[model samples]
Target: MNKVFKYTSIALLGVTLAGCSTVPLTGRKQLSLVSDSQIEQQAAASYKEFLGSSKTKVITGTSNAALVKKVGNNIAAAVNRYLSSQGLANQYNFNWEFNLIQSDEVNAWCMPGGKVAVYSGILPITLNETGLATVMGHEIAHAIAKHSAEQMSNQMLLQTGGQIVGAVTADQSMAVRSGVNLLYGVGGQIGMLKYSRSNESEADRLGLIFMAMAGYNPGEAVKFWERMSNGKASGTPEFLSTHPSDARRISDIQKLIPEAQKYYKK
Candidate 1:
């Protein structure tokens, strides 16, 4: 039994090392025990199902919806260009899509693969285009950094070692399908992909740069975050669950602005 445990630990370490990957732009290394394409395919299907469900009211033909798409596309294009320049375009084949959902959720999220949903309730807080860009840029940065995949990978690592090793080695996609299911529900009920505080801070850093790349001023993110901080409440805004709005976060965003300004578009 001792020898068996030792070998299993060795095997797990090997898999962990083999699965290492670096996040784009931030250049942070992450473990990737699951397939990226598989997660994206799942997200696309979940996104379509959510859109088609009767519970989902997809707003369109209005300026708000149009603005969501515009902001999303601009950031996507800028991000794609950056990836291409970095020779990482092939690693990420995201079919970007954006939608505005008619819900008073006061939240927005970007799933794996470039699928984005902006809830109408957050519009008042956003106030204007630059504010909207701040929201979208931050949410999309979560996807670009593959935070979801990293979370799932960390979960996989936490499972019983022998079972996890077998599952990882035998069939990665099938083994992790449950993780996707846990994060998403096809009936227009999205289980929030609540990330760690570290992930949120990283997303903020990347988001500022992304918004700047899309021609929105990175400094505006501070104001948006300030508004969010002032309006913090209990258990209502889904955004706050994963994203804690406070003075420290705002300070961190302020600190990151100088680096992001380097990528500012005219």
Candidate 2:
């Protein structure tokens, strides 16, 4: 009787878990135990915390930061317009905000709900509005694709024997601890190197489409990456880590350009 109950429970759990999801643009089916709202809440909190801890440098003068914001908002508008056309507009509750931080880290990211940060450092490599659009589009693509929720779902499935499900719950404390640990592991193992390669490529593909749709030239993507690679050669060892180089990545991006061109407004 006990054995029967245990086996039956496991089977039921497995069946429920089988309803995984596949990301758009890249058909990677993932175990998504978390919801968009949950991810949005988490992202909002973290974004606020990071803003508190990190010094933010707002660009007001006729500087690169101003250019980045202009480009980023254009891309964001395009994304929203596209999502609306696809009948999935409700998926994003975007309150778009772009901030330029005074960091030489050559890094930028978009949190789940359209909070974006571009370091002053990456601007040199980005070079111009078109280059900045490429980077912003890629980061925003990650958010629109709901990668964070997908990652949380993966962790939940692994940790809870498929018992834990959904985004919000009575498991706040547990979820917080687990989420922090999961993010650390994801950043170190997935985001930084090996695992993120596929995600990076997918972002590039979608980013190109988004930027082109926003009226930016898709051709500039190749040159932007080349500049990035030149910078990488001297910076921290992202090569020793993972991610394709300028040449290899540009080749892949070029292959996707024909498809992206279809979405280009000009």
Candidate 3:
């Protein structure tokens, strides 16, 4: 049994090392057990299902919808230009599409391969073209950074660790196994939350640069986030939340403006 545990630990360590990857621009190391093609395949299926479903009302043939596409395309083009310049263009093969959904959710999201959706509710908060670009750039950054794949990889690792724990504890009492599993589950959730916050921060940073490169003022990001913070309900603390505190995010964006401005063309 000791030999089995030793071998398993060594194997797991090797896999962890092999899976380590650096996030673009941020240079943050992340686990990437899944391939980009796999993520894109899943995203394509999910995006189709979402758009086809009755739960979502996609708005089209309107000025607002056009604006969403315009801003999304600008950011996407800028990101592609950067990737090409870095000789990483082959890393992504995006079939970009942007849609506006009629909802009051005050949110937007982008999937792998540049599938994007913006909620009408968020437009009021965005308030202008620059603000809209701020939101789109951030969401697009999440995809460009491959955050979804990183998250999936983290979950895979956590599950594998749990299975290893269970195997090693096979001789223990059922109560002991259950207790250990419970503790592991709690720890996994906390770890996931931390990763999510980190992803959001990275997205914010990358988005600022992308918007600037796309000819949008990076300074608008601070204003957009401030509006979001005002609308947020008083709930979980920053440590427990899956996003940075409003003040912290605003301050960070302010500091990043100069760096992003370097990429600005106008």
Shift in Å, residue 106, candidate 2:
0.4
lDDT of 3: 0.89
Candidate 3 lDDT by residue in tens digits, 35-144: 99988988999999999999999999999999999999999999999999998889899989999999999999999988999999999999999999999999999999
Instruction: Give the better candidate number (2 or 3) by TM-score.
Output: 3
List ranges where model 2 is wrong by over 4 Å. 1-19, 161-195, 231-242
After superposing candidate 3 on the true structure, give the runs of residues whose Cα lies further than 4 Å from its correct spot: 1-11, 174-176, 231-233
Q: Model 2: per-residue lDDT, tens digit, 1-266?
A: 23333654475478447757666656677556667777788888888777777466555575776877888889988888888887777767877888888788899999989988898899898888888998998999888777667666655544553233213222457766466445444544544354456667778988998899899988788888888887544344544444666566878998998888888876
Ranking by lDDT: 3, 1, 2
lDDT tens digits, residue span 126-190, model 1: 99999999999999999999998988886676454536444444444664545433322331122
Span of 10 residues, lowest total lDDT, candidate 3: 1-10
Name the 10 consecutive residues with the lowest summed lDDT in model 2: 161-170
Q: After superposition, how far is residue 70 of candidate 1 from its true place, in Å?
A: 0.8
RMSD of each: 8.0, 7.7, 2.3
User: Which clashing pairs does model 2 show?
Assistant: 33-153
lDDT of the structure predicted as candidate 2: 0.74
Q: How do the candidates rank by TM-score, highest first?
A: 3, 1, 2
Off by over 4 Å in 1: 1-12, 162-195, 231-245
